[model samples]
Target: MDGLGFTVDQMAEAERRGRLFGLAGDVLQWSGPPIHTVQSAADELGLSAEEVARVWALLGLTVTGPDVAALSQADVDALATWVALKAVVGQDGAYGLLRVVGTAMARLAEAESTMIRAGMPDIQMTHTHDELATAQAYRAIAEFVPGSGT
Candidate 1:
């Protein structure tokens, strides 16, 4: 099967094994430049396959398309930043981060593809992960903000 198909298969396997909740990215060993295998991405980020899969599976959408052959370096970096933010934020942190980053990442991917479709504009979704990480941190703090003793 092609790379996108293979990625779906891997995701299914992860879900079946119940490791989907703890996916760590290195489960696939992807070597291609743009298409990152789960295992390879995990290794690159010093994360476990289980952790990567877990985080990945939490997304409401499935990643597909030629542009999604491998996790772009930019996306991979963003995911790593999200994970690091998760460290200090924990479960609630993850919830907020996922909600925000997941949507932003999706938009960023769309924009990237648009650029590619529009003759490869020099603009790219860079450092979005950092922006996502910051958003998560802010959300965590917001949760604690005093609210009229509601």
Candidate 2:
């Protein structure tokens, strides 16, 4: 037994969790690029710290600090997309969309966590341990949506 007194099964399960956590980026399709700190993202995007903070909050998260590399490449890319969208939708409209999407995603995440905690398969609502690719998951969602016109 290890010093922590964890059984062999427990140790193996812990390692499995660690590996899955590491692959979360690939699961989420966050393969655009590496990330930067909040301050660096703000300066690079020509946005203010307050503005960046707001975006972080809208995504149902809080930035620990300006120097924390907590944001991902997709996060920065979304900021750039926001800038372009703001020109067309205006700030209020953009924030509205962000709020809706963020809240929806948060609920989905909670449901997923609950399903996992129950030791049930949640991916595509199947009972297999198959890992899902981000693109495949997106397509599944699109296909499931009624009147999505896809």
Q: Candidate 1 residues 1-150, lDDT tens each?
A: 123234666567656865432222222322224667667778888888666666676664444432334566765787788778777788687867677766875676576446443552221223233433433333333343233111
Q: For residues 1-150, what per-residue lDDT tens digits would candidate 2 score against the true structure?
A: 144244566456535764332133232333343467788888878889778889879978777687876677777887889878988989999999889888987887677557543653333324434444432343343343234211
Number of backbone collisions per candidate = 27, 0
State in Å the error of residue 28, model 1: 26
For each candidate in the order shown, give its overall lDDT on alpha carbons.
0.53, 0.62
Candidate 2, run of 10 with poorest lDDT: 19-28
Deviation in Å, model 2, residue 40 alpha carbon? 0.9
Model 2 per-residue lDDT at 92: 97
Give the winner by lDDT: 2
